[model samples]
Target: MNLETLKQGRNYCKSLTLNDRKILEEMLEDDFYIKFHELFRYMIDEDLKLEQEWFG
Candidate 1:
């Protein structure tokens, strides 16, 4: 999920019990960006290139 979804989930957790909220918080705390960055770095090292035409 994205940052906005995390924020909304956190707000929703406010009404939950402390233990339940903590469980959800821990589950949501994975560092997704680091994993994504590593994937991008691997692609770059493998000579992957993006073309504007691909987007259009």
Candidate 2:
């Protein structure tokens, strides 16, 4: 996604209830977090690469 989409996602997450955010944080502490972290990193790297290709 683009920067605007990422910002929207952040806003949506911020809009979540405190308890929901806490639960999400707890979920991120599990083994699945590693997989998700890796996936997110890869996606972000890809997005940056594409942006550079188009703009730079």
Q: Write the per-residue lDDT of candidate 1 for residues 1-56, one digit (tens) a residue.
A: 33333333442322334564454445445565553444334333433323223332
Worst lDDT 10-window in candidate 1? 47-56
Clashing pairs in 1: none
lDDT of 2 by residue, 1-56 (tens): 45444443442322344564455456557776665554344344433222233332
TM-score of each: 0.27, 0.34
Query: Against the unseen true structure, what C-alpha lDDT does each candidate score?
Result: 0.39, 0.44
Strongest candidate by TM-score: 2
Q: Give Cα distance to truth, residue 12, candidate 2, Å.
A: 7.2
Candidate topping lDDT: 2
